[model samples]
Target: MKIIQKHELNSLKRSVDQGTEEQREAVKKIIHDVKQRGDAAVQSYTKQFDRVDLEELRVSEDEMDAAYESIDGEFIEILQEAEQNIRRFHERQRTNSWFEPAADGSILGQKITAIDAAGIYVPGGTAAYPSSVFMNVIPAQVAGVERIVMTTPPGKDGNVPEGVLVAAKLLGVHEVYKVGGAQAIAALAYGTESLQPVDKITGPGNVFVALAKREVFGDVDIDMIAGPSEIAVLADDSAKANEVAADLLSQAEHDARSSSVLVTTSRELAEKVEEQIETQLKDLPRYEIARASIDDYGAIIICEEMDEAIAVINEIAAEHLEIMTKDPFGDMAKVKHAGAIFLGPYSSEPVGDYFAGPNHVLPTSGTARFSSPLSVDDFTKKSSIISYSEQALKSNGGKISQFARLEGLEAHARAIETRKERWK
Candidate 1:
């Protein structure tokens, strides 16, 4: 990782809004073809991208059963434990419809309803993420989403990974489809003959998938357009250089564009961490990818004080922030913008990524400045409820009409006036 001064941080901010013209055009064509041709377009794109030709798009029960049999008992047990943690955590986030009644016979409240159906996009190809299945599906389930569908690209053999299938089946998501890429997003946004449309979509994917989500955002609700995974560790003299280096590399291995930054008050520790990263990268299996990411996007910022470090962290608004300082909890109070905060050395980022209860699908590329992690709230909608008695309308209608008239909205003024006249 390159060592840079604090002023250079602005250059490290990943451009979340920019995409190449070729990528946008390709995604647009795929989405258009899918919208026009339906399942045929989806199938063609699936073959083109995944190199798999499938007679069936949906995963059958028999295949699910085979997947269960293929996996061993220990892994299944681990998945069960993760699911319970995820479910328990999200259940706390569930909200109920409420109404507040007033003495003037007015009722005001929010009616919360889960979306009818939700689709989650899971990536396939190099890696298989059963954890993603748990993280993405469980929150929708907690929110009481009626139908949860999942779409993942199949392998060259035209078979979904056994682990992926097993995780989906565990969550009771049987409506698994063997489609991926921009076309799969289009299929989810607009219904096809075989796959039904969903009300909302969630989960992360490649640039094409992210761009596709951006394109179909209005047609269907989607989670934030996630960028490359990133991690920022704020450390002091007390932190172990090796552990900090290891944690930074954990995120760096995610992709060539992933950002791993270390901001610390200790210049001595910073130099040690720089050395440790080089030592550790030699043994890492994904060394090439991690090296490219660290060489290009990674940084070690030496701050003068903890407050300065905290300010730098907030400005970056990293997706994951870890504090290995003596008082991590105390320092965390000063942090305003990270998507997920990992306190102390033991609370490494991976804990939240897999086993811990919090959803792993976090806002990336400085989106943490405004957006948040995917939760039950993403799968639900809120409707405002308003009720007014005759006496209440008579008391307030004249003022409402006057305000409406001030805005030159005659129809709005008349509507209130008509109600007031009836009450009188």
Candidate 2:
């Protein structure tokens, strides 16, 4: 990993970044093809990419039953446990519309309403992540979305992963389709013959899926254009190097482009963490990917002091920030930017990702400065309410007419002027 002094680091603008153009164009093509061909085009991509050829593109009730039965009882217990935590956390985010009655007989307030339908995209093929299903589906459920649809690629054997099916069933996702990549996003945005279009689409996928979501945004609402996972540890001499290294590797294994940086004032701690990473990398199953991530995007910066370290942390605006200093809360107050802040050693990033209440699908590639984690708010919208009684309108009519005339809106001014004349 490269080491840099805090002062030598670039500005905050350069800290958070995005992926390559080539990847973006490739994903655009996927979106175009899916939009043009629909389900036939989706099947073609699935065959070419996932190596799965299927007669039907939807997971059946029988399949869900089998998936539930196939999974071990102990794992099911864990899933339920994680589901409870996620549900509890997101339940607090639910909101209701309200109205206020004025003394003058004018009522005003905002109305909150949930979207009619929501689509969730779960990545399939190389891996099965049941946790993602819980994180994405539970929030929509809490938001009171009418229908929840999910799309995921089927394996080469033309079957959805048992774990994924079980998780989806537990969360009450209404439908599951054997679709993936940009095609799945296109199907969600512009509904295919079999699949119904949704009001919003959420969840994480590969580069193609992210770009597809971006392309279809105006047509349908979407969650953030998530890039690779990243974590920044604001550690001090008090933090254990081994524990820090383990936490960093947890996100590193996500993708080759993922970043794992340690911003600390302790040179000794950095060296020890480096050594620990080297030792631990050999034992990890996904060490090759993790190693590439750490070598390519990882950094260890030695700041002048704790405040300098905090500055570096804000610059990166990492997706998952771990403050392992003696005063994690004190440092947290200074952290102006980050998708999620994990204070102290006990609060690892995985806690938020899996069992903890907060959403794990966070903004990546420095987009945290502007983007936000998925929540009930993503599935609901608020409309401003306004009402003016006849008396109130009469009182402001002259002023309104004058304002409209100043803006060169003759029709607007005439409308107010006519109302005022009637009152007179």
Pick by lDDT: which candidate is best?
A: 1
- Estimated TM-score per prediction? 0.98, 0.94
| Per-residue lDDT over 69-176 for candidate 2, one digit per residue giving the tens place of the 0 to 100 score | 999999999999999999999999988899998877788999998899999999975689898899889999899898999999888789989999999988877499
The CA root-mean-square deviation of candidate 1, after full C-alpha superposition on the true structure, stands at 1.0
Off by over 4 Å in 1: none
Query: How many clashes in each candidate?
Result: 0, 0
**Residue 9, model 2: Cα distance from true site in angstroms:** 4.5
What is the overall TM-score of model 2 with all chains considered together?
0.94
lDDT of 1 by residue, 237-322 (tens): 99999999999999999999999999999999999999999999999999999999999999999999999999999999999999
Count: clashes, candidate 1: 0
**Ten-residue segment with the worst summed lDDT in candidate 1?**
415-424
lDDT, model 1, position 150? 97
Q: Clashing residue pairs, candidate 2? A: none
TM-score of 1: 0.98
